[model samples]
Target: MDTAMQDRALGAVLAGACGDALGAPYEFGPPLVAEQPVEMRGGGPFGWEPGEWTDDTSMAIPVLEAVANGARWNETRTHGRLLAAWSDWAQDAPDVGAQTRAVLGRLTANTEDAARAAALAVHEQQGRSAGNGSLMRTAPLALGFLGDGGKRPLAVAARRVSDLTHHEDDAGDACVLWTVAIRHAVRRGKLDVRRGVPLLPRERRTLWLDRIAEAEHSAPADHTERNGWVVAALQAAVSAISTGDGLVDTLERAVRGGGDTDTVAAITGGLAGALAGASALPEQWTVLVHGWPGKRLDWLRSLAVRAVDRTPGPLGMPVRRS
Candidate 1:
């Protein structure tokens, strides 16, 4: 890949991580002005404090690692790698959702029916929950499988990885849509979610809506939250691109929009980064973010090259000859 494309990929990764770290401290707050650190602490609560990313990015890293190492779809090896990564992150035990933590705990115990039981428990308790967790970690799937000339194969692979924990049809479908959308955005530098939403086909959309409605209907009556809010995240991402807004603004809107802040910010930020590239990010924010970083930034840069370099052209050949 050329320098420009490489930089774009790196930018996407950095943007995603930076967004996650910046939004972490204010995951649950009001829409207008979410609580952040005091200005004396660096003009923001988490600023200058070496922002720490949560499970959103943690889960994504292994997905990239697995793809880079050539893990196949639905394979036990791939699933095991994902589980092992979750285990490693679980050891540190950062602030994670109750449902996610419980699933991880069971997986760690090495129980006989750990995987099945965990999936069932999440589905039962959450009623086929379709949160943004699946979408947040799906960027790599887009980057990894782009131009592979097999959307079905790629979607199946990405879905298996997503379904390791989130098995709901809508969640899985959303994960696929987000992944493919990012791939197109990164490659072409643009995509229309509104246009793409309808392209999902009636049957598929109905399937997704069904699962979402099931989760919503099964949800306690006290729950007034809208499951369609997840679509709001997708809309927010598309709006960021259409309106030419910066990554931070887009991410802030996603987070403050409420209901699954981190995941929404993560998915939105990932798409924005892929569309806008690293240069689109604010220099000050990038410097601050990269300053405290390790392989997260470096891997992002490398993966960007890989993303462009891997796109296949006519007759399954590489489109751009490096």
Candidate 2:
């Protein structure tokens, strides 16, 4: 990989961990004004120690690990390992979304078509199953696709990964767009939040454009950007990226935006960090934040770099020519 993309990949992972840990202490609480620059304090509703990341990064790490280990599109080995990791994590993860909890529960108990069966059950139980569950951990999918994939591979990998725990069209669609945004930021040095619109199905495109409009132009009174809803989370994270002046401030804005704060901030951080590169992050923040799966920032950085270098996905190519 070129020096620029490599740095951006490193930036994505570190800043994501940083944002996840920074927002951990204030997950569902009212947004707090920073009396000072944000710190990675623990003890949110989950109550882990300082610098510990939450379910957002915990779930994401499995994907990153599998990708770094060379898991590609529709590859059962990676998916199975990810499922096993989810089952193990359920035993002790500090927090899990309702959709993810349901899906993982079924995956643990049954071996046949676990992802589809679990999602089908959830759909039957609840008329709709759209949540931010799958979207939060999808960044690595993009990194894996960066080698020889384009819009089609990205869309396919995104929906398939999301179906493991979330089945709603909106959730799957959000994952595709967000992953594309991350890739765009890494390669091009900026986010095109609407890049997914042209790639979306016709019906979803119209709905999404309307949704994006509401989210993009939302005033605080509108409350378009808050909570576990996939649309709100996507909108909030993208809006924060578009508006903030730098990586740190962008993350700070996402956390202070309130409602599902950690997820939103982590998502935003991944995008902004990719565009800004690791140098954009505060050194102290990277030094403090880490994965609960026992990965420090440097470990996460290496995993991210590997994901970009290997893991060609369905296309079978390297990230760059040697």
Candidate 3:
């Protein structure tokens, strides 16, 4: 792989984690007006430590790990691995969305079918399963499926993975759009949320196109009230990435968008990182951002690199900081 593309791949996950940690302290708070300083101080409602990532990046770790290890999305074993990893993470996760907790809690079997059934049951019982939980963790799927032929597989897998915890069509649609867009950004080094609209069911294309246009025409905070929903969450992330002047500003716009700040920023960071590359992320945030599985900057970068290049290395073995 070309070095620049590889750097963008690394940026996809690392910056995503950075965004998650950066926004953790501001989650659920009221929207911040422009010029309000945003920092990674990390002591929000969850009482997270400075630069600590939340469930957004935590849930993504297993997906990255599985894909890096050569797990295909179509395999029941792959789904089982993802479910088991998530079950383990949720056991002590400082903050997991109620929708995700419900689905994972209902998993009596570790198979893909069983997970889907559990998710479907939750959706039926709750009457809504379109939370942003799935979208927040979707960046890794894009990284895993990069290259010329990665789009179709990525789309299929993104929906299936999202369906594991979010059974609603809207949730699945959001994942497909975001992951595909991330893949495109990683390959082309540009932002284009609408690039994935063609992957959606024909009837939903125009609706999503209108939504993307709305996001482009407005600011991230405009979606805050409903940012918990998958569609609005994607909108907020897109707005931040499309409107902000740079990587830091893009993530800050997402955090400022409010309500589910970590998730929106995490989602934004993935695409923004792909477009800007790992070198574009502020070193201050990268140095501080660490999370579940006892990982830090190097490990996150390894996950992204290994997922795309499929090169063998000590995945997360610590080494001296560069």
Per-residue lDDT over 1-322 for candidate 3, one digit per residue giving the tens place of the 0 to 100 score: 6778788878888889999998999999999989799999979999998999999999999989887887777777888989999998899887889999999999998778888899999999999999999998988887666654677778989998998889888999999998988888877787788888888999999999998899888788898899999989888988898788989989999999889999999999889998999999877888898988788877878766677666221232221111
What value of lDDT does candidate 2 attain over all alpha carbons?
A: 0.77
* Model 1 regions more than 4 Å off: 2-4, 33-50, 108-117, 148-150, 194-202, 206-232, 239-244, 256-259, 290-296, 303-316, 320-322
Which structure is stronger by TM-score: 1 or 2? 2
Q: Could you tell me which residue pairs clash in candidate 2?
A: none
Clashing pairs in 1: 37-45
**Model 3 ranges off by over 4 Å:** 311-322
Clashing pairs in 3: none
Task: Summing lDDT over every window of 10 consecutive residues in candidate 3, give the lowest-scoring window.
Answer: 313-322
lDDT of 1 by residue, 1-322 (tens): 4555555455556677767666565555344343543111122232334455666777777776666555565467667767777767767544555555667766744332466467667778767556556667777766555554645555666667666666566666676676666666665666534223344546787654444344333311111244233444444444434443566666665555544455556676787787777777765555544322244455555654554455432124443422
Model 3 Cα displacement at 233 (Å)? 0.7
- Model 3 scores a C-alpha lDDT of 0.85
User: TM-score for every candidate vs. truth?
Assistant: 0.76, 0.92, 0.95
The sequence of per-residue lDDT tens digits that candidate 2 reaches over residues 1-322 is: 7788778877777777778888888787766565645567778788867877888888888888877877766665566677788888888876888788877776634342677788888877888888888888888777777665565788777888888778788888998888888777776676677887777888789888887777677522134334588888888887777678888888888887777878888887778888899888887787877766777887888888787777544577656532
Query: Which structure among the candidates has the greatest lDDT?
Result: 3
**Residue 293, candidate 2: C-alpha displacement in angstroms:** 1.6
**Where is the poorest 10-residue window by lDDT in model 1?**
37-46
Give the alpha-carbon lDDT of every model. Answer: 0.57, 0.77, 0.85
The Cα RMSD of model 1 versus the native structure comes to 6.0
